[model samples]
Target chain A: MASMANQGAPERRPGIPGTPGGQPRGRGLSMRTRQLFWVWGFLALPVLFYGVIRFYPTLNAFWLSLTDWDLMSEPEFIGIDNYTRMFSDPEFWKVFRNTFTYLIVGTPISLVLSFLIAFALDRIRFGHTFLRALYFLPYITTASAMAWVWRWFYQPAPIGFINDLLGRVGIPQMAFLNSTTWALPSIMVTAIWAGLGFQIIIFMAGLRAIPTTYYEAARIDGLGEASILRRITLPLLKPTTVFLVVFSSIGFLRIFDQVYNMTTNDPGGPLGSTKPLVLMIYQTAFSSYEMGYAAAQTVVLFTILLCVSLLQLWLLRER
Target chain B: MRTQILMAGLLAGTSLVAGTAAQAVEIEYWQYVYETRVTAMDQLIDAFEAANPDITVKQVTFPYADYQTRVVAANMARKGPDVLQMFYGWTDQFVGGKVIQPLSPEVFPHDEIEAEFFPIVTAMKRGDDYYGLPTAVRSLALFYNKDLMTKAGLDPENPPKTLDEMVAAAKAMTEMDAGGNLSTAGMTLDMGGQDHQWWREVLVRQFGGEPYSADYSQVTYNDAAGAAALKFYTDLQLVEKVGQRGFMDEGQAAFRAGRAGLTIDGTFRLGSFSSIEDFEWGVTELPANAEGVRSNYASYFANGIGIGAEGEELAAAEKFLAYISSPEAMKIWLDVVGELPARRDVALTEENLADPIYAPFLKGLDYAKTTLFIDEAAQRQNAIDMANRILIDGQSVEESLAQAAEAEQAIIDKAK
Candidate 1:
């Protein structure tokens, strides 16, 4: 995607200066340039839209962080006050830890499960398209409703779906969402469930993109399926792996909706055990009406994401 | 031919735009009442529209929980309603920043009925400036299962007179199964998060301590009286074991189901629990801790019309306000809505106060008080945290009160 953007940049035409033959070629070249200009103009609308709508807000957020601005009052410039308060605020630290836990626990579980499903689906010969769509159904639903459904599913009593299932098997009912010790893990489990469908589809595309000739060539060498997968398939899927890992990590870092909606009994309920960084920022900004502090927290979140993305790129680069 | 075709298309497009353009002055009113009073709102809007002939009133109904956050967001986005329905706790914050316009008591002409409202209604007005008119009132009261008290060898007619007697009766009334596990509880000590702030405030006042002082100027919850209040509330669940510890809504559900002895709630819940046919229930004053300190917290909301902060549609908005607040209009509003009226003359009606279900609330309103603190959300949230800590975490009363006072004072300091 990045390379495609570079290719679209306009370059000056060469090989035409002062010769009589060059004049005819230059006229033809000018006609093509006019055509190219229209194409570029069409593409510029979306590019400019993304720059203004997405990038400008992010830049404004950074500037807003340095000032104490209620949406109503004139902003008073206060350097680092919000950041300093955030450092000392116990609630921020709790939410940060919760978000990190979701990342560490949720990302790997999703990655492994998705890859396994992708590998199996790729090997199946019958109804592969139907099965792929079935597996991908969850990712297509806008997430809030799905998150709410998961919340009811994780209710802290025997009435909860999972608890009822466990109960029918003669196991004791569990307080999945109510107990502080289990709340984050319970939320993470539902998150991984909501998350796995998308990752599987991404990995399946990566698997299908690899040509069968490489596998055929390996089969003739008497290599087993496991050996072929380990040696051939894994080596060729580096770009997809990089994409999934980076995207999944960012998703985990900003896991707000599941935690926010699922545990509403306390607002930041269940002893604030399931509150994430994004939720904390939202509450501070809107509920507490502290826009400056929320802006500062947004900056911190941005820094964390930027650092994580850069680190992943460095770590997963081709050797 | 091409010019004729283009001219035909232009004429049609211009007519379509002109036909669809709106003509009336649009004002939005956001509220929490639904199902119970939507018919009343529609009627009120109909009457207002008929009276004004120029203004259009649009009613936006949201679930009760979503109102504050939605209003705040819309206001920040510069798309807020011209008029809003505000809870008792929200009035101070709205008035503090001058985000809302004040209706002059002089300009408001409903045959000059200012003297007809309770003194508590005047609390809605900040010195020399009134933001809006009072629309409805709610007060907390003690709701008890009469059959259970009788079955436990207690007099069904005699309710507890003081806080100490209330605890003893609860201890005596609590029932357990053979396994010694708690099968039924006597009372719950305001166990829920956030919503229990009103209960905590009433407890503070019952002990002769105010959460904030009378002038709404100072927070006084961490003092000796505050500690006594906290200890009394926590002791019901922790030390006495007469009430359940952590399960708030679950326990309240149980009480509603006739499995518990007592629950403290507001007058609004009468409509919800009116269908319970198994157990005979009755309402009485929420027990006071100190004798002669009969104060209880009032929970009411103000719904009135206001001009947009841009100050454009004052005449149309004021006309609508006047139309809705008339005595005949208030009757239609209250009967369909089930909210107790804010006007003293309307509330004193034989039809409203005559209901036996309203007995406890009317008694509670005798000493009823509204929290006068600014930064109402912060004060409410801190009080909730303090109550939860005392009941669930078993913290000392002094510690809980100290933490609550500190949290609230910080919010107060921030505004300054």
Candidate 2:
């Protein structure tokens, strides 16, 4: 019957008369099925994975903020108590202050230095890759090794490299990591050194992406190099700038590994100067085993991070 | 949207069937001893299996650095190690929360064993209730390079009898090359060893000051004796300039390479140094701070054995522990492993105490003092760390001790 119908299309497939009327509709249905398969297959796995690993945990953590659970027993619902205690925690404010201090002082300095280097590299004629790799080498180096090297450099003794260099120029030995006053600043220096590489790379990429015609147009208009950078480069690199700014804020806010490793988790050590917030949460959770309290701390940290990210998006996000 | 619906339906369907499934009784055990020690632990499992085969012991060893964090995370997950090793400093945190199983003399019968072992061995316990058992015991003893002492005109047989004599002899024995680098130093302090507290606390005790008060309510070291002790230690670095920072400058290398005269450390490192043959070394008692006061805290590297509350392999776990601590088995541990015995009777044998190398360490145990088995051990350690930093880092002795006192008081108050 199918062969006869194909051969002649006789009487609109009389054996199954309604099928002819539904042919275009059936083809449309199959097309929709194919579209759904591709769309769901490509997109669903990532969404599910993200939901379970990141989003669910974050949401559960926030929900956990309203309860008391020590990971042993059933969670007790104690609404707003954890949040309430956070308001009065002196250590919270101190840690928050330390993080802000690091971001405020360290980030801008690193960004500016990286920008200058990138600008210079863009203008250089010879050994550009070598110089770029040289500038970027420290970033690629392992954090533990770099931290140790920086520690040796910041050693509080006459034998310290920095101190010895200073002595050559008639300056006395300074306790870079040992003094309460100098320890935070010393860490900031390390942070700036490590961060500058990535910033330079990002800025260079943005610079490269900018059309040469913009510079040519500016030159025809008799604009200087500095003015062109400010007018053409800076304004056009909004996306990159916002990207760096938001990412760096998140990085600085969650700066626990450096603070913990560098300071050996000594609270108020060398005068309680390098105590950052995330470090406090770690000390509370693992070192002290105050999970419920640590959970409380984590919720506050999340809130702070979330608000900052949202504000940055609001301020710098393109329409 | 269809995928989400399908996933939701599948999950709901699974939940309905999950209500009828049997839950596995999970038991977790965490230890720091890895490699052969883990294999040695299996002998206990065999014995446990023979007794009551229902329970299973899932043993794991974490790296030293991550052990604490892993345990904490496990606890947070509501599935922490049913039995875990708590160090000297960390014991109090467990006891403070009452999170650990209490081994009373009634429950585990450690009364005779406790008396036989050094009093300080149970320093982490509270009364008759102990959170764990002493798996390894350690104490500080003088380790002298016999060749260096003899070459420097000091009798190798007769080590320093007094602090003054030690200082004088160290000064005499110390030699410097023409270039003025430390070619051979007379003595250096072991500041980072597990047993360092024994020597440091003993020295402080000699000056007539206890680290914590009799009540455990105050840190009493901020006063005159504490100041004197602090000054004396700092003088070794500042005024005398005799000793090097043992932690920063590797003491083992100094000893093996024949650059050091005298070093003091625990018996545990004896295993690590058993193969060092370049120099002849002898062990002796640590120098007394006073003429006679034996005021050292005993340092022990211990592992606890306990049955999981609802573990499937409870019988197996207990049997494994018994097998490991047996006389024959523990002898293998003591002789081959070279760790000092947690059992006094096993320790006194010809292989352990009678040997020339091990005899002097045995003798030093006579003068040893142990820490009080209190709940606030870690807090005491924090206070001690402050005191150590002050003395070693050239901070004011009085101020450091005072800060330590303040810190100790706060911790004590919280514990109470």
Candidate 3:
């Protein structure tokens, strides 16, 4: 083992070509050039992959958004007619509002619930790992499966668990996932629940990273638990909060699977009340075969994501 | 080394010669993955291969939801099927996208196809060319649970024959829990499913309205007749309170679970419904309105030769298409997939007409209308949204019908 380790160490050593303190084999290349060659050689695969797969398609979408391509005929240059049409389309505005509703209602509820659970979990010693794992189960489960289960829960009496429970307790049956007013919120609740596990795990990690000495110092100063949480804990957890806010905000904005699966028959349905922008884009592209219009919708989504993320980063800057 | 090289060359030469001696053409066939349809196709392929031993056919399937997208993507990649099955409603999109080539006149004679196949098969026609053919066609019918009807004190043998009778039966069969939540829905009201078709093709015409103009270029279901049709549908839930939407999450689910007294579904449901253990269900023609005006909706999935096929593959696909639409293959499709044979003679045979399960759907073909949908999904969603407006948003029937008409007209105009 010792001899093997010794052999591996010298070979891995940077910029020293063959043998320890040996003369350079040739004056053909400098140390920096050789180092850069190795660096780029390793990065070449990923760089090429992103260039072809990600960057090319992204640029193509921008060009496509300006044209009218129906995936059959040649794309005709339309000079922002798609943008004009999208702005005037009432469906697009409904989807826009729905997407914002998911972001606004879903993010804070998930974050606060996760933080509260994580904070309490971090302070406990008994079966902490098991409870954390329990909370994290939904995170690892497939979103479609989770959405279907929630869909079953939202069914009417004799089939739906929630409605059955309500009936048992003498409460009127709620028309969840059926009522236009309730469908979005019902789906939002599932999205929030599906996302809670990941957020909780992240919050726990952030909680663990906080120095225990600060708490000890606060205890010595006879600080209340709430004050210690507000003054020391929250302010210290700012970085994690900012990251989660941006991450989850992006997630909520681009929500699709739960909404699609829960309303499989009529996705974004109950009069398009539950439709997010992504689903609308999907329907436009695949269902209607309006590729250019879908591309325009994609451009709008990308812009929204950019602005929202930037706003969050600016708002949560280290001040 | 010299000896080994000589031996390798000799082997390669012999194999190349052997390959040229007996050439076999292989073609790929693509369809949506329905269990019975796939099974029936496999059986037909086996029979076809036995007769034409030189041609090999491969079957590929995608889920129904993703079938069109997959086919389009595959065609774009130059790896699409030689023969493809497509919904009759998608003929326009498929033709526009060049997913399929028009059937050659020499192989599929236009006169023979028009005469032998049902008139509804003409939906595949564009311009002067026919692009596809179907082995089987489907039409809607009333599916009733016998047990539920008997329990409701209605005669199980005699299902509803008139619109008023159907509503009365639905009201009688409906059972509510102590909490006033529906325990058993008298009828399934799924606007997203076959209900949209029922409303557009059946109810609208029965209520004295033409859903579309003769050329199918304009929407005409926004008048008083259309509003009355829309009102009757919504009244099943709002006023009559015979059923609830999303009761068992889906209309088919409620019917299958024996929690629904009646459901309006296509003949494609026959195989699934027949498989239910110990369940007694019956099929009947959709109820006629006052003055005995009867209307129904007919649809089918047709097989087409993909644009990707060329030379030997094209010949093979043409042969396979002919074989699948032949009388023998249509019979197998009827037995296995439970869809009515596309050929009028094949479907209207005494044996098929005598079968209680298929008779109602077969009879429906006489009065059924095949909607020339340019964009079936979008147009169906318009109907669904129109229903939601009345049922969910409490919008007036006239307003909802007008909105639906406008939306449908826009779809038609865009397609044009």
Candidate 4:
């Protein structure tokens, strides 16, 4: 039938019936080609967007790290000088330590807290949906607004709620944002709280995936509650925990908005005690307009993020 | 006959539009958004446009935190506003980068500007060129809670006159619980927020040292005088325990809420202070040094014309600048917004000089200074670190001051 149609229009070049490109016609589409068509049709838009918006600038930043650009005049190529200067700079090292502090401390505390909440939430039957939504509220709130509210809570007596409650309990005032030692941890508590909602929802979904029969069987076998949690619940929760560990680890690594908003008076202040790598990059790029130096800092942040996420995944993998 | 009438109407309309275009020129004015400032600026623009029908002024405002960055980005794209409002400290960077053009010498002769404005304008001038002009200037003054002073059994009418008396007053003003936590602060030390500004601009000079050279070459605040200044300020908390760092929002909120005895803040604070009706507050000059030498911080935001504008656009911007700096605009801004007039004649009137609320700020104008640097933020951060080193770690003020000088000197060097 295809040959008869081609003979009817003999002047026409040999080609697929519907496609614009001239080629020999086929009776049916191959499975791989059809699959690719659907996959690429969906991927093309995001691929174009990432290439234009994300990938190009990322590549440009790699090139810019080797140059001197102040965002005003044309960039000047200066070899490895920016990196050399950054390595020797004391401020850079301080910022590096601060960034890691967020990652190492923030990730585990947030994960454990979210898991506990989700664990308790999954078993509850009365008002379960309301409780779940309440836990998820902070995840949807704007980060800066949340930081400002947390800042108010950290205030001293007569102003800060935490201090007022402490004073009522006969406890002495504990400096929060003011003291260098306490500022980072105080901020971390807020960050973890803000992210707890999303993690809880994911964890609940993971908990729900476990078959009820497993728990019933264990119950019949005379297992205690703690044993069931340790043996079956935790083991099944490994995947959810791993996903959150990597996601929240990256979130903590690039923490900026909270520290920036909280420390607006002197951003990353109280001796730059709370200054993260991202905040430093922001200051370098926007405040000082040292685009080249900022790019170098950004490159360091990228590597740290990449390495930390990979390490967490490797360590958390099933053995 | 009908076609002729249509052609005639079209020609008339075209000429009328062309004539209006030929007569008027437009210039864009950029400022950081403050509610009062935005409102005041709009009023000024409206008045200026009305006065000069041939010129039209457009206003643009950005949030305070991102204004400078926005201006820089706009200029980089060659879309900068014709007129830009920037801080006194930012003048150095703008001048160094040639981001803004100097005031037209024909319109603003050097002598006219010097005679018109206060002595602070001299610092604003680079060599012979005047980079910009302030519509209003702000200086720090002591704002005290009258109710708190009365409770402390001190006279609110008579503020401290000297350093020792200031400390004595603060000590008396403080109230503590049995466990030794402060129930009421005598005064909040600038603390980590903006303590650096107070240190470099006010105390350094009072302690007999210049924070930085007039030429912007070196820092002298690391010497003996600097340590003495830092110790004197920090001693309020460390030795006297008048106010500690643990309090939240201690500076503005503490004073306003009647929990603090005193605070030193900019004249711009008047807008917020005016809203409080429960307690009466008074403004006075900050206490002098033990030697009776007084100084204050006078910071101002000035308007400058950005680069790339020429011909009618630049001329139009100059016209707007001249209008804003005029006595009328200055008075309107001072009344609506709360800074003292930059024009010496306007601020020194008998009515203004006698007004108790604004007079103390006006008195400080003679000895006030702005900390000039390429990047005031970076230099200020150095000051913050120096302060934190002493307050948090119990480090010697002498060592911290020394470290700050080296760090700040490097920042200035990099800007060059």
Report, for all candidates in order, the number of backbone clashes. Answer: 0, 11, 0, 0
lDDT of 1 by residue, A21-125 (tens): 543333444545645655676789998998999999999999899998766555689999999999999978988888888888888889989999999998898
What is the C-alpha local distance difference test score of each model?
A: 0.73, 0.66, 0.91, 0.85
DockQ of 2: 0.11
Query: Candidate 4 local accuracy as lDDT?
Result: 0.85
lDDT of 4 by residue, B1-416 (tens): 99999999999999999999998898889999999999999999989988889998889899988988888888778898899898878887677655788898998888899888987876568878898999999888888888888888999898888778878888999988765678789987765444567778778888998888877688878888888889988788889888866454647877778788888888888888899998988989877987889988788889888986689998888888898989999999988897889999999999998999989989988788766767877877787778778888889988888888998998888876
lDDT of 2 by residue, A87-181 (tens): 78665787778888887777677777888899889889799999999889888887767876776687533335786576667666576766667
Better of 1 and 3 by DockQ: 3
Between candidates 1 and 2, the lDDT winner: 1
lDDT per residue (tens digit) for residues A1-319 in model 3: 4334334544455555755664464245655565566567678999999999999999999999999988776789999999999999998999999999999989999999999999999989999999999989998999999999999999989899998999999998898998999999999999988888899999989988999999999999999999999999999999999999999999999999999999988889889999999999999999998999999999999999999999999999977
First chain TM-score in every candidate?
0.86, 0.85, 0.92, 0.87
What DockQ do the predictions score, one after another? 0.15, 0.11, 0.68, 0.50
RMSD of 4: 4.7
Q: What's the TM for model 1?
A: 0.81
Task: Give candidate 4's error at residue B202 in angstroms.
Answer: 2.6
Q: How close to the true structure is residue B365 of candidate 2, measured as C-alpha lDDT?
A: 61
* Candidate rank order under TM-score: 3, 4, 1, 2
Worst 10 residues of 1 chain B by lDDT: B190-199
Q: What share of the true interface contacts does candidate 4 keep?
A: 0.59
